[model samples]
Target: MVKKYTVAIVASAMLLLTGCSQKSDVDASAQKGAESADSKLNQLGAGDGMMKLSDEEMKAQLIKDLEGKVESVYFAFDKYNITDESNSKISANSKLLGEGKAGELKIRIEGNCDEWGTDEYNYALGLKRAKASQDAMIASGTSADRISIVSYGESNPVCTEHNKECWAKNRRADFKLLP
Candidate 1:
């Protein structure tokens, strides 16, 4: 009975000692960090930090800054190779991308095709065309990381008329800018 009583007393004393211990520095620092983060979030919500633009505003700004500055690279029918004529266009685009706001923006190369081949074939061809343009841009000093490729195939045709001129217009790679 005495041993049991001593053990209970010792356990109670240990509990009391632990309960009375001071908070650790880690706990205090964590609390301080949480408060600092909350304050920063509040400041950001109140627009005290850098200005943020709305999606529409950003799109308009991008259009204003880069509309028609980058030209579409046209490819020959049933071909994905960058021709001699397209080199001039690629060089001009690289120059534009190297300077001003265009340099900082990410580029999307959209590959388009005429309604001549099967959907699968057109998609593949379009992808190849986009890849070719991407390679050309990289060769002309544009960072490959900044450029992305997408193939719209025949779904996004610039001209819908079933004619040579219209099909020629549709076979192209167009550049888009992203924030």
Candidate 2:
């Protein structure tokens, strides 16, 4: 009777310990996934010595980074005033461009428009958008010589869903740096 009782107690303890270990392992995995998600939303996922990307690497990464960093202020049919919301995004990109104490890079601002406007009008509007971006870059300490502007009008759109919503997306500027 004593031996049987002892054996039963030992088995229950082992089972409990195993279950607790599995629970802790699951908790650790959940924590890791949450950290990954936070990195994605806030900034580029980087770690250790690899976090500091080189100037060449930075230049290569600018186009994609700027796409997410820069916000386009929508105009009412035909206008060029920076909105309050857009100002914030511009400010962030400005800091990123100005603060990096590294090699100077060349950037091209490509302006675009939706298909609703006339080709010529859209070309000019696109130019206005490019000019706006170029001016902002200059204000951010990027040299004028390093920045150039081009207008794509309605010819090239990052999105082509072909509606008011899709057209709005095309009516913006793209910032690309030479890598």
lDDT (tens digit, per residue) of candidate 2 on 17-131: 9999999999998887563646555775555667789866766676566556555545445655556665555556666655453225566778888888766988999889888
Query: Would you give me the overall lDDT of model 2?
Result: 0.71
Stretches > 4 Å off in candidate 2 = 1-74, 101-103
Worst 10 residues of 2 by lDDT: 97-106
What's the alpha carbon RMSD for model 2?
14.1
Instruction: Write down the lDDT that model 1 would get.
Output: 0.86
Q: Give per-residue CA lDDT, model 1, range 1-179, as digits (tens).
A: 99999999999999887766645655776786463546665655555436778767776697566757789988888999999889889888888877875687888999999999857989999999999999999999999999999999999998889999999999999988887
Best by TM-score: 1
Give me the displacement of residue 52 in model 2, in angstroms: 14
Error of 1 at 134 (Å): 0.4
Candidate 1 Cα misplacement greater than 4 A, ranges: 1-59
